[model samples]
Target: MSYVGRFAPSPSGPLHFGSLVAALGSYFQAKSQHGKWLVRMEDLDPPREMPGASDLILATLEAYHLHWDDEVIYQSQRHHYYQDQIEQWIASKEAYYCQCTRRQIKQSGGFYLGTCRDAALTPEQPCSVRFKVPTAIDHFIDQKHGRIAIPKALADEDFIIKRRDGLYAYNLAVVLDDIEQGVTEVVRGADLIEPTGRQINLYHAMKQPEVSYLHLPLALDEHGNKLSKQNHAPALNNEEPIETLLSAMTFLGFDIDAHITSANLDEIIAWGCQNWSLQQLPNSLASTARF
Candidate 1:
């Protein structure tokens, strides 16, 4: 199959340094393989989304020359698709409704213990839908991280597909969109490592072939905290595109000595695609950064 990858970001805030690194990393990886790269705005949670964050993210990507190949897809507009799949899961008993609160799940020792799997729950108001994950365990080979085994205990735990707020959850929306778009690979951050298992399970449940994954090393601050919008991480300076791109390159452990000073925007990106290597990346839980 010809490679197809994506850089999906939630529009909760402006594009920050960590955002740039993930975007550029995915961009270079796809471009290097001469593959199509798509962008998706994860705007499902209106309560957490900023009004102008999606537009600003696109502008920031353009400023960095990290162009997406197709028109960006927004999650909020695809509610019906998600709803259809949720209905299928519920009707088939592959998923069930839960009225358990966060406190209730916490009381079960952090991980949900299938308290409502057989409770004859209904999707009345204030109820969440959870997939009845099977006991069959499996593993996947990440393009960069090599082999990974999914823990059997976690795999058997019932996980949510739709929130009690009558809104689509991240796992469901992401899997549905990836299937719709034919995303061949997923390139993102280390923070999402655990979620990958649940996503793979969803793929099996949906009977769609799983896509490959390459989780880029997470960028942490001087205090060993990951740079994130929730932490109020500063947005990137579009004024200095090349400098910011270089900083991202460095974070990915790429050597930019050859074009740091000799190339313009296109040349720099061209060089990045040609020389990108996952071998140079640090697989530690996190990598320190000052960018």
Candidate 2:
């Protein structure tokens, strides 16, 4: 299959340095291989979404010249797709209704133990849908990090695919969309490494082809915390797009020449695509001190 990668971001806030790093990394990873790069807005949760954030994110990507191929996907609009999958899983007995709350799970040894797996709870009753994780996927190859092992407990736990509040879970939407988009590889931050194994199981359950994984180093703040919207990391400066882009590129382990300062956005991005290599990236968390 032709290489296809994506950068999916939630619309809870503007794109920050950390998010920019993820976007740039995915963009170059796809472009370097002459592959298609697509963008998807993880706008599944309305309660947390900031008004106008989605448009702002698109503008930021455009300003940085990280133009994506094909029409951008929004998770909220794809609920029917997610719902259809959930129904199929429920019907096929691959997934079941779960009424266990976070407190219930927390009080009962943290990870969900499938308490409601055979409860026979109906849709009319308040309940979420949880996938009955099949045979555990203990490990998967990470293009950047090599073979990473997952704890068996995590791999075996039945996880939620739909929340009782009626919102489709992140894992559910992401897997379905990636499969729908025919994503050949997933190039995102290392922060998501924990969910990879479960997502792999989801692919197997859906009987869809799995994609390669390349997790980029997470960008950390001076305090050593991962820079993120929740942590109030400042948004990317659109006025100095080149400087910002260069900073992100260097963070991804690119060797930027002083002369490159005179280059335009397209030239800088072309240079990035030409020089992109996962081997050059730092295998640890990247500090945002350069920013």
- Where model 1 places Cα greater than 4 Å from the true spot, the runs are 136-138
Local accuracy of candidate 1 as per-residue lDDT tens digits, 90-189: 8999999999899998888788888888987776558999999874445678888898777776767888899888889898899989999989999998
Candidate 2 has its poorest 10 consecutive residues by lDDT at: 282-291
lDDT of 2 by residue, 1-21 (tens): 799999999999999999999
lDDT of 2: 0.91
Q: How far in Å is the alpha carbon of 85 misplaced in model 1?
A: 0.5
* TM-score for each candidate, following the candidate numbering: 0.96, 0.98
lDDT of each: 0.87, 0.91
- Indicate the TM-score of model 2: 0.98
